[model samples]
Target: MLDIKQIREATDFVRERLASRGGGEESLVDEVLELDERRRRLLAEVEALKAERNRVSKEIGRLLAEGKREEAEARKRETRSLGDRIAELDRQVGEVEAAREALMLRMPNLPHESVPVGRSAEENVVVRVFGEPARHAFGPKTHVELCERLGLVDFARAAKVSGSGFALYTGRGARLERALIQFMLDLHTREHGYTEVWPPLMVGPACLEGVGQFPKFKDQYYGVAEGDDPSNLGRLYLIPTAETVVANLHREEILREGDLPIRYCAYTPCFRGEAGAAGVGTRGLIRMHQFDKVELIQVVRPEDGYEAHEAMVRHAERVLQLLGLHYRVVLLCTGDLGFASAKTYDLEVWAPGQGTYLEVSSVSNCEEFQARRMRLRYKDCQGVNRHPHVLNGSGTALARLYVALVETYQQADGSVLIPEAVRPYFGEERITP
Candidate 1:
């Protein structure tokens, strides 16, 4: 959520930045301002009525003490009218505040000044390339073909057991997934200085709202129906990413300035509807309703936000570097930015078999957008409370990462050589047929 004071003071600047997003939220400024004005006006009226009622009560007490029964009753009637009026104004204030908050919640974050002025992913700029895609001795097979030939994943049975967008890894495939998770978790915790957390797979709607997911992407997640959960958490929904839960671990918290930067990493199964995307790139593991990902989040001082952004991106890039994968980092254009992110960088890994680049992670700096919603703040040197900035990224999504890994390392003789970094965890991981 944006600071209402900022919007009131710098309406033009907010409008211009939101315009760059090309999401049609620039007009929201006027509506928000109107509601804000109404809320303030109503609150003022309520306060005035309360003050008047206080004076009238004093007068009524004075009249009753003076043995003037008729005057006291008449003053009491005036007080009752004032009370009724105040109550109505209070209700109106509540409604206006709710409306204003709803509008603000729907508005996407203002783009950072450094973000490119573009309209789509096509306009995104490539920041850096790691290495060229590896050359193959034979016609490379797609991840689907390799998985089938190696008896790694059972797509047919997965479809039968669940639905079309699920995968059941068998034998070495399951082992590889576990190895990748452990490897990423260890890398983030030990070297990247992140605290490992095991978060619940389901979260309340407020958690999603705090992360800028609810009331917009609400339909994209799976919810546990009323009776499905024994605990009955009021229709809790499956987390779309570990960030949905991990980033809000400090919701409604106040931290000391010394603890300005806090890092966390979590591995979780992400669930999404992927609505209407079946016609796009639903090939193999490219898009799935359920997928595994190691998510990272950082809470830092406002001035250190961009620096943390760069560091978090590096933390994600290190995973690919250790895996010996060819990949590139791309800066997202304004229109391509996520709803909660002021700026974003996507890590695209090369897949030899697919002959295309697939996004494995997105690192972003939200710049207090999420912190404001979470009511997460810290005390500064000046003894003032201020919201902190939030940075988040995927250490890597195991599904697409898996696709790139298998397709990149497929041998001419039909075996898949595991990357040396995960060899210790995978335990002789040349998944031979």
Candidate 2:
């Protein structure tokens, strides 16, 4: 959540910043200012009424002490009327404040000044590229074809068991998925200095709101049915990513200065409604309603946020480097930034079989945007409590990464060669169907 004080103090500045990101609202700032002004005015009126009521009460006491019963009764009646008016003004103040909060919650975080100015993914700037994409003498088969030939994934059965946008891994395919999960988890926890966590797959509305996924993106999530359990009653959604759970670990918390930078990695089966994402990358593992992901989250001091963000991108890139996959990093432009991210970098891996690069991870610097919503704060050395900056990235999403691996390592004989880094986990260097 944005600081309302900042918006109120520098309305024009906020307006211009939002406009640069193609988020121009002609009267958004004006509405906020008007609501705030009304709230303040109502509060002042209530205070004045309370003061007058108190004064009248004192006068009533004086009249009663002097044995002037009728005068005291009149003053008492005036105090009651004053109290009623104050209650009405207080109600108006509450309404105005609620409206302001709703608008603030809907507003996207302002892009950092350093973010590139662009209107779409096409305008994203490529910052770096890794090893060259592998070439094959024979035409490389797509992951779907390879999976079918190898008896690895059964899309037909998956559709029968669940529906389309799902995959049923059989034999070596299941093994590969498990190996990749363990390999990525080990890489993040052992080598990348992240604490591993296994969080609940379901979270409540406040958890989603803390991560900026509720209210706006509610339709993109799967909600749990309300049953007899009272605790589970309200809005509950399956986690879209482990980031939603891990980033909220410190929600409503105040950490010490020594705990400035906290890193956590979690692997979870993510569920997305994919409400409007019907035909885009629907084939194979590129897009799915249920997919596995290893997510990375960092909470750092404000001064260290940008640095942590860069380090996080490097951390995600390292996984691809170890796997020997050709990938490139693209800095997301202002218009492409996520709702809660001030800046972001997407890591796209080359899918030779698919003839295009697919996004495998997105590292973002949310700064204090999420922290403010979560009320995640830390006490500085001077004992001043301030919102900490939050960052989240895919150590790499598994489905597409799995597709890239399968296509990149397929042999002419239809066997898949495992990457050296994950060889031990797979217990074999090559997977021969």
Candidate 1 has what TM-score? Answer: 0.96
lDDT of 2 by residue, 242-337 (tens): 999889988999999899789999999999988888663355888999999999999999999999999999999999999999999999998788
Q: What are the models' TM-scores?
A: 0.96, 0.96
Q: Pick the candidate with the highest TM-score.
A: 1
User: In model 1, what lDDT does residue 170 have?
Assistant: 92
Choose the strongest candidate by lDDT: 1
Question: Per-prediction RMSD in angstroms?
Answer: 1.9, 2.0
lDDT of 1 by residue, 1-433 (tens): 9999999999999999999999899999999999999999998888888999999999998999999999999989999999989988888999999999999999989999999999999999999999889899899999999999999899888888887789999998999999999999999999999999999998999999999998888778887877656676546899999999999999999999899799999999999887767532344888998999999999999999999999999999999999999999999999999999999999999999999999999999999999999999999999999999999999999799999999999999999999999999999968898
lDDT, candidate 2, equals: 0.90
- What's the CA RMSD of model 1 in angstroms? 1.9
